[model samples]
Target: MKLKLRVIFFLIFCLPGLAILGYSAKLAAAAHGLTSTGLTANGTIVDHERQTRRRVGQWYCPIVEFFHQGASYRFTDNDDCKQSRHDAPTGSRVEVVFDPAQPSRARVDSFRGLYGTSLLSAAIGLPWLLLGIALVVRVR
Candidate 1:
């Protein structure tokens, strides 16, 4: 009975961790591809917004505006993957990398901006995965 329970718990924890790892891998690959084949543009930090979370403190998300193909595009760096919320200040200039076919799909041209989410996800998921594996091995 204990072994069965351990197995069940292992599956419950391991499956989500594996899924997160897969998703993070996909995100990292897409970011790498975009960085390699995207066009560069100058972007301006227009504003900053504070995103509040239940348990976590407020996060500062930057609103950046840039031009592509003579049209203006605005992007918000609001994803929770960044280690720091205060990455950019208002009125600062940043380099943006955008897809030529779809300018709306863009990211700040930096290592953290491009792949921070995936790296963060991997960092979190890997430990869960290892714990799951250890639980399963102990069950045997």
Candidate 2:
């Protein structure tokens, strides 16, 4: 294959894949940083805000409450489950991970809550990356 064509194809396929992979890695690193280095406390699943999306149908945003330094902080989790998931029902106990400087900005210390964004991004990026590699190798 022509060098220009190869370079163009590599840019088209590899660039976005690498960008996404880098972003996913950054997200995962942040999540891990908060989990391993931030403060931790026991929290409760207070409620869930019902939400609807076009084509994605229904979902629920979990509301959680926790205490840190004699202060109670409540916030909706950033876990994006695009379905009626009752995995963590109201009154359930969960681990809350938070930064000491900003307790209000906390998250549930579950697998999905901690790494969902990264996992989702990797799901999109890894395959695209592999396809790009395969295409570039076979583009003779």
Candidate 3:
């Protein structure tokens, strides 16, 4: 009975914690790669809008436009958190960081825009990981 419970606890906590760690690592690696090798350009906030969600209320997303190699590209900010709409007002100029080889793969050059996912993932995953470790120690 005790062995069964230990196995159940390990499965419930350790497996998910490992998965979260993997996800967070992937996010951090991607952000590092972009910030290290990407090119920067001045972009304009072309549009700002709010998306309504039942659980979280409203999230703000901004659309930005920039020119690269004589061509124009527009991309929406990936942040969907509340108050994100207020971060960039329309017509405001902002920095854009993009892959030189693929201009379409770009992001707003801000801490939140670039590292938010990785930060959030780490924040959530760290506690789960600690708890899983504690549980494993207790089982042993």
Choose the strongest candidate by lDDT. Answer: 2
**lDDT accuracy of residue 5 in candidate 3:** 69
Task: Sort by lDDT, best first.
Answer: 2, 1, 3
Clashes of 1: 0
Q: How far out, in Å, is residue 132 in model 1?
A: 1.1
Question: Between 1 and 3, whose TM-score is larger?
Answer: 3
Give per-residue CA lDDT, model 3, range 19-132, as digits (tens): 887898898788789989999999998886677778887677888899999999998886534466565567889899999999999898888878888788878877887787
Runs off by more than 4 Å, candidate 2: 80-82
**Sorted on TM-score, highest at the top, how do the candidates line up?**
3, 2, 1
Ten residues in sequence with the least summed lDDT for candidate 3 = 79-88
- Candidate 1 local lDDT, 36-137, one digit each (tens): 999999999887777777788777788789998789999887652333545566788989999999888988888888888999999988988888888877
lDDT of 2 by residue, 1-140 (tens): 46777787688888889999999999999999898879889998888878887888778888899998788899988674536557667898989899999998799888888999899999999888887777777778
Deviating ranges (above 4 Å) for candidate 3: 80-86
List TM-scores for all candidates, in order: 0.85, 0.88, 0.90
Looking at model 3, the pairs that clash are 60-85
